[model samples]
Target: MCDECNQYFAKKIEKRVLEMPYFRDVRHRNFIESKKRRIPVSKGIIGGAVDLKKRKDFGTEVIVNSPDIFQKILNGEVKHMIIPVNDQPIEDNKLISRFIAKIAIESAAQTFSSKKGWNNFIINTPEFKELRYYARFGDKLDMWNYSQRRIYNETDRFLNPKVSDGPYEVLHEQNLVFLRDRELYFVLVLFGIEYVISITNPKIDGYKSWLIENNNKCPIIEKNERDTIKGERYF
Candidate 1:
């Protein structure tokens, strides 16, 4: 948030961009387009697994299911907050994605033991009920599809894995904090990227509306345009 921090991150990002193999030829063009269009040049998401065992607690992952937690984060009651990233940008570039993920993890560690951390993350009963309803019954139509059901089953396996003959236990209880950490990491990274994009591209219009309307569409690909190439190749 500070000027120094902003400059530091910008420099770090620039350095990473320069080191990338593709940047040698396209560097100048990329820089020009980025500054001109206010679009962040991204490298894409970081691949591979994150080790959550070594990570400091960023509060209970289940707390995200509570909308109030987001409100508290916005209110600054929670010093560490994870912002959800728009899927479009990540799909477009890998460097920005990796940078955002790194920042999220670092931010969590930076504020892990803050006095004003997760103490205000108390669950709201009504909110919990609403979330539960949506998770269970909100998408009945999609639930009937075979592929959707399979995906849901896989998610269930991860979130509530079986233990011997006993009932399934929550993932965190099973010490699968890595899953939670990865989820939080992506959310925070996305938030950071979104914030940077907004600041740099203040003149770009309809960004919010575009996000809403095309949330499910691929940002790197133009649907219904037969001659247009998709993904990073287009650039």
Candidate 2:
């Protein structure tokens, strides 16, 4: 499912919770429960500090308060975990906590433009510390997707320019990168984050050879090349 689907379903559950009068009654309730009942297993408290920069481009890094939550994910308890790709340290700033809470609120609330708006909201939050060096690996993956889409659409346009095919008309291949769980376990243990391949489909000229050639080029980054003992280049 896409990001929107994830947000929409989260919002539906949040709305149902808010409809209860007991929610306000337990305003000061502890992290996971309310006056009405215990919070479900699917939900947990997540807090974090994130920094974003758009020097000549955009990059974001977040250090969350809940590394244990990530451990739970690694253990197969959390399914749909969207942890930040960067492994920065948590700032000793409390004011920034509120900004993080707001983003969590928006993400859970599933409001429109919440992602972009929350980025701005966090940057302006008062206790905002010095701008840490930003991470662009995620952005690099995003750029690859955009580049693939551009090639896909331009080909489509060349083939049929009379009408617009809309966004979904472009075909995207599902690319998967295999990783050793043990290797990731160690990396996450140390850095709290692990780099992953940003897979893409390369549209080449011709049919059978095109498929074979692109399949060969499918993994822009190779496996086992980034283990901690190694220099560890990103995908």
- Listed per model in order, the count of residue pairs whose N, CA or C atoms clash below 3 Å is 10, 0
Error of 1 at 126 (Å): 21
Error at 4, model 1, angstroms: 2.0
Residue 151 of model 1, lDDT score: 8
Which candidate leads the pack in lDDT? 1
lDDT by residue for model 2 (1-235), tens: 2486446434543444333333221221212343444342122223322222112122322233467755664577755523232112233212222222222333323432457675554345432211110111111222211111111111121122333432222222222222222110000011112112111121112222432655533232234322222222211
Mind giving the per-residue lDDT tens digits that candidate 1 earns over 53-151? 111222212223345655665677766433222222323343443343334334434444365543232123343233223322323312110000000
**Model 2 residue 30 distance off true place after TM-score fit, in angstroms:** 38
For model 2, the run of ten residues with the poorest summed lDDT: 182-191
Task: Show pairs that collide, candidate 2.
Answer: none
- Which TM-score value belongs to model 1? 0.22
- TM per model? 0.22, 0.15
